[model samples]
Target: MAPESTNPRGDLTSEVLHALSKSDPISSTEAFPGVPFESIKAALDRLASRSMVTYEQVEREEALLEPEAEIIVSHGSHEARVFEAVRQAIDGLSIQDLENKIGDKTVTKVGQGKAFKEKWIKKDGAKLVALVDSINDVTRDQLKVIQETRTHDAKILADLKKRKLLKMQKVISFRISKGPKFALEMVKEETDLTAEMLASGAWKTATFKPYNFKALGADQHAGALHPLNKVRQEFRQIFFEMGFEEMPTNQFVESGFWNFDALFVPQQHPARDLQDTFYVSDPVKAGRPAPASADDKHDYEAYFQNVREVHENGKYGSIGYRYPWSEDESLRLVLRTHTTSVSAAMLQKLAGQRKDGRVPPARYFSIDRVFRNETLDATHLCEFHQVEGVIADYGLTLGGLMEFMEIFFGAMGVTDLRFKPAYNPYTEPSMEIFSHHKGLNKLIEIGNSGIFRPEMLEVCLSDYQISSMKIETGGRR
Candidate 1:
């Protein structure tokens, strides 16, 4: 008959209990040197779960011999082998003859150099001859000692490691001790009470397992706003706190007139080219701009004529582009290239306030997506977000614009700003806003700001005899 199988974990648990009965504490490494570390930890965990025992983990680093060092320990050092081989031959041995005798070209070649360096061998013409009759292999002796003891002098260990003859490995063990519920034998315990146990009056004496309230429970995945939308919300809150109204920029498709002509952008501008703008196809064209509501009594026809005349010829004491502006081009529908198109429409409505009374000082802001025909790259994309703000009031100066920018950017923790002179089609004395970047160690352009020109405002506010108005606009991507 075959012998019965033994359970290592059960045997180890029982042995641990018996050992603990005699000693208050014991080390797993000293008691079970040959046992696997994982198995010992498992038995300890099982006993600890029942409050019968406890343990602490112990870690240490051990040095061991490499395959090459082991071979040297089993046989002899390379230099010693070469000396013995040469001495055994009455005459001398050639290079090929030495390799054939050793059956290893690498070992023969390395051994020959070491023997020569030690003055144990000399070159006798094309052959090698032994200079000594005997040798003691100190390398083999050191490796043998390390193989048995797992350690040696620090300098020798470092030298052996540098030569790729040894390596270090981490070893884990445990120190165990008895707990409050320590016992020689494990007793069966109930985890839950049943109806039969209750009816049999056994629930009163049942030893229920203790609940581990500290144990972590299952994770509950929750919904959250996207990172971009969260930032948009923060910008909106900032604008609201500054007494700015949000613009309706939900309309992605817009007529070219509101996008460019009313903004005083010429038809020959590079931004209107097919290479830069994404023109819509299905609708073919859009109707003339009209009132958004019947209550809005703004003159749509006269406003359209003023935009055409201003772009084609000089108007309101300004020299226009002098090119014949095409009405068909103005009506063509296209994807709005920037949120500035919405700002223009809002400004046009604000101009109509002149008919009711004096146009009030107003502030408007928008954070929305815009489309462009851009080459895809690390920094450029066809679709992206644009942040724009328009502030219109009487006697708003360039200094005021700069101060407003400081307060606005400072709210988001951005400071130390510098402005560079730039040119824009619709704004006079445009400035490119820049901020110092600590990471790049240079100034980077953050946005653009400028005051609106008379040519752009005249077409909208001309009906109320308002030739020009101070309107500041700032934008960033």
Candidate 2:
């Protein structure tokens, strides 16, 4: 049938309103495929001169239509008989009505129910097409109307398929043409006339080629442990070889007594600022204090008294900085602010025991992750590991602590170290450890070492140490 001359889309001028909507625009040569290539090319040049449709060389994949969309393995003949049935029944008819009016095959299907199983259609039983079922084999013009009115998936695309609308057609076929230009006015063949053998099949090929790529191996491969981790492991070997027991990897989340107050960080200490420590997001039960029998009670009472005396009257031979300690501050749970808390608990375990009272000398070490808030960069990490060591014995000294640190570092092949006087609220006469990083050409402060203040030890462990050991890697900022 000839298309109507009274075009409903009106004019080319009107098409400009929907210029962007028009997909799969083909050049004149492609539009009239059966015509001689040059004649259609000349027509395209003429159309370009008058600007009917602009020509472009875009990557066709960028268009809305895709390659797989072109090859619909549709069922059923697109005969006008099927069209008439669908048109009359779709408005109010159900599947049974469709089957009765059309055929059982329309819904129950003649073969495997692959399309129906895909849920593209609903069936009352078998051999009936649903009123709402989508149809196939439409032209570009039919697709435009379907698109404007679509309330279902694949309908517009399927309609365009019915009309043989193509978003992209490879020109390789036209490139091998054997005819001259202006061979048009030739009768269009409705049926295949190539007389090609049915057994001829499609084939494809695969090959490899390189394009733009980026630098994938940018990180250095120098054989070295991660700087932070290397430090942590060095810690474990150092203290274990020094005869210190390993501290608990138990709950790294610690209460105020173990984290701050136990370590002599006063309730008012600015270091307890939220930005300096990570606090748990939720609240948890803090249990009742450990029970103290009369003997334990006397020991606890005695430790508290001595600690108070040291803080107020210089029991350690120096007047301690006095600040009120709050039990609430001791209750807050934080990332174990220091591995020293592990040692503090260990001491509490060993408190009140002499070699005669069945207590043995003990030292301990911890190599674990610690966290802090810091600006992130290649140089600064928000969380890193630390190496901590504590010694609990009858007679340990600051000189012994220094010798241990030097020996441990030396065994780890760390040669360059320096110690300078520093301060920790929990330690007395503290010294900060520094290392020389030859690559950076600067003296890097490595860690801290100090004698734990007697008052701090008494609160955490409530045991008066004849001497205390405090060594830490990754200093508190």
Candidate 3:
């Protein structure tokens, strides 16, 4: 009969310790006769956790036969069969005749190859003949021994494994022994004071478990912001310090109209191609912006029409790209390739303010994710972040844009600065900014700066001068 447990968990621990005390080193399978193996293992682990018992694992590699090896055992091995067929024939058989006798293409092919390699069979002109009058089929004999004994000679096993006839399997077993604190008899430790023991004045002698101050505690996993978000917060603080209001950039998907057409990007531009942008498929198109209300001061619909007209023909004293414009193409949905889409929307809002009254000098900034159809690599990704800023006032110039870059990057300790002439569809006289990296001992192009083109701002803020700059800060890999 099995021993009854007083406390199931405590009794299991006690039983393990008791078994170890008698045997010194015992297999876990032999310790608990009636208990499930998993249950015994769990109890052993609990004991190990408390340092009351220790265990060593033993692993044995045993050879097992696969289906092909089984066939070799039931029938003869391929090479052995070939040797037998050759020896029995008075005149050696030809390759064609040998294949007919074997009846298996695999056996004929593999058997002939191994037989020749071992020199067990040699060619007698066109006939295959046994090299010796009598031969031992070593592979067949070894496989038989392994099948019966469930073990193998190391060298024999290697050949069998190479031929894929034998598989080596690892079997793990455990040896458990009493640890330093192990004891046959156990006293359940009281974790707290009881009212009955206190009233009877027995609490004074109650046993308690010793405190293990050296034992490590469970890990506490706490939430943390992503590294990009941390840098974004720092950037937000910098923007606030520079007295720039944060622009809302919650929308990741934008209509092609605002993202491209409104920015004066021609419809035929390659940036709108499938290779360069990710377009939304389901609910594939977005509703056009509502036309300006007749009574409304902002006149958004009027602005939309004016933007379309400018793209299709000349406007604002400039000859536009004289090409057909499609409102359907403008309504197509896409993942915004840049945060400048947000800037475009904000500029339209600023235009509405201009319509209401005199335009106030304003500074806006954004830090957020943007997507592209880029092939991913060590330094480039399909999606990344952009730190974008725009300042709108009367008479802002390319010089004002340059000064802002110096002060902004300079505040972050980037003092060495150089600018080169560049171009953008929406920005005239664009300049690419580069900063000297002391560690790299070279200049790295950091960002792009330019004054907003008259064509882009004609409808939005024709009355105000605007300059914009965008700096692409690389994203997490």
For lDDT, candidate 1 versus 2, the one ahead is 1
Worst 10 residues of 1 by lDDT: 466-475
Stretches off by above 4 angstroms in model 1 are 1-217, 220-222, 463-477
Q: Report RMSD for candidate 3.
A: 19.6
Give one digit per residue, the lDDT tens place, for model 3 in 1-477: 123344344367677777787887886344465555556667777677556788876667779998999899898889888988998887999988888999998998898898889888999999988987777777888899999976987998998899899898875556898877676766567777889988999888887666768878888776788788887777778779988999999899999988998889999999999999999999899987764456546666787898888898969877999999999999899999988778877877776665446666678888888999999888888888888877777777677778888888787677789999987898887888899999999998878778778788766776634444444344341
Report how far off residue 320 is in candidate 2 (Å).
Answer: 4.8
For 45-150, candidate 2 gives per-residue lDDT tens digits of: 4333333444443221111333322222233322323444544654444545545665546333322243344333444444334443354533333434433443
Give TM-scores for every candidate, taking all chains together and pairing residue i with residue i: 0.54, 0.46, 0.54
- Return the number of clashes found in candidate 1: 0
Q: Please tell me which model should have the higher TM-score, number 1 or number 3.
A: 1
Q: Per-model C-alpha lDDT, please?
A: 0.81, 0.55, 0.80
- Model 3: residues with Cα > 4 Å off, grouped in runs: 1-206, 209-225, 291-297, 355-357, 464-477
Candidate 1: give its CA RMSD in angstroms: 14.6
